[model samples]
Target chain A: MASNTSDLRSPLARARGLGSAKDGTEHWWGQRLSAMALVPLTIWFVFGVIRHLGADYTAFHAWMKSPFSAVMMILTAVVTFHHAHAGLQVVIEDYVHVEWQKLALLIAVKFLSFALAAACVLAVAKIFIGA
Target chain B: MANGSGRPLSPHLQVYKLPLTAILSITHRITGVGLAVGTLLLTWWLVAAAVSPEAFARAQGFIGSGFGLLLMFGWSAALYYHLCNGIRHLVWDAGKSFELSDADRNNRIVLGAAAALTVLTWIVGLAVW
Candidate 1:
């Protein structure tokens, strides 16, 4: 009977590997969390952009000089990039079946996201600090 | 016995009715892709601002042109849609909205809020300009 197959395996073997893939939940949860963080942050950033629309360079600098706006902008940039990375990672994972290509893309996305986020934060800091 | 080869499967799109949820899901992917490209625009804007007034003006000119404005508007819409739907996903992640009625209600709310936010952003842009 087919029951013999189940009985042949150790209990540890049967219980240890019942899932599709390990550590997949982290990706799922991070994507969800970053998305959640982006909700209010994106809304705030949109209004911030609108408030600065038509502003001259000096005015734009002044607007970003505000501590609160600067902080929010940095946070928005980081969170948005992180959210984008998570979204794109899933897209790559689903569609890019080539092993090396997928791995390279995943790494490239992380690098770009981090670099952009860092640049945004530095720009915000410089704007605020007059550096 | 002679055997017959099976008929080719009909294409899925012919049979698949485009549902609201399906449409929204596809739009979410489109907006995600759009936003990814739009990030380059944001990076350019920031870098220009950081560089010099001349550079900033150049960036502004690009962003102010007809095509640029159209792209900006699209980006704004994408941003709003992604945001609202993202919140919807968050709620779903929390194990809520499993009921059909609640799911429908949440979908409507997401769509409506995205529209409202996009309109509001455009209005604010118009007012500013």
Candidate 2:
């Protein structure tokens, strides 16, 4: 390996960490934001599930139509997927070593999570609009 | 440590008799990964419900089946545990819960509560269904 004598970058910097985004803690804040949102949204979802237990298609459709439920569902899907993407990106960065592979996987995770969330939101919106 | 101190906490991992807290920490990460993957079921069900009566029924049949129930049992347990531990993490993020004994106690509590919640949810779920 070729060494650069002119390379003034501190060894401490190399040993201690990887590249910093330098833009601030956007990722961390975004994650916490989503988490706080989920606390209430998740609770609502579970309770709603219990309430609608043994419900058939019409019941579910009706449940989905309520403006309160429809809006909450959209928020839940968007925030959950945003949160999941951020968390998974961190995990992949921490574990995956190969540079290209890591890049590929991160992009794929971003794409997949967003796509799925969009689909879910669209489904919820359809029910809302139909009613 | 210091740069020359042979890496911070290297001896601690080796020296600790049993790192129960450490184990729980890793399990938190694993369960997070599992839940992320398992969320495909949620997506499928929502899409099916939006698509048509037939599609929704097909989704229902799969989830209500024995194999699907088993998967749900595992995923639901993972969900509860992850949620419990995740709240613990958020607490720690607020600069609390640092005492070693308290940390251990809370870890146990998180695990216990998750198990109880999972069982209770399923019991009610099955009973209702």
| TM accuracy, model 1 | 0.83
Instruction: Give candidate 2's whole-model lDDT.
Output: 0.84
Looking at model 2 chain B, which ten-residue stretch has the lowest summed lDDT?
B7-16
Clashing pairs in 1: none
DockQ of each: 0.54, 0.48
**TM-score of model number 2, chain B:** 0.86
> For model 2, what is the alpha-carbon lDDT of residue B103?
93
Model 2, range A15-123, lDDT digits (tens) per residue? 5544465545678889888887887887787777677654667888999999999898888788888988988999999999999999999999999999999999999
Tens digits of lDDT, candidate 2, B43-99: 998888898888888887887889988888898888788788888988988999999
Question: What is the lDDT, from 0 to 100, of the residue A1 in candidate 1?
Answer: 39
TM-scores of chain B alone in all candidate structures, in the order given: 0.87, 0.86
User: Model 2, stretches more than 4 Å misplaced?
Assistant: A1-20, B1-18
* Per-model tally of clashing residue pairs: 0, 0
lDDT of 1 by residue, B20-86 (tens): 8778987888899789878888877777777777887888888889998899989988888988887
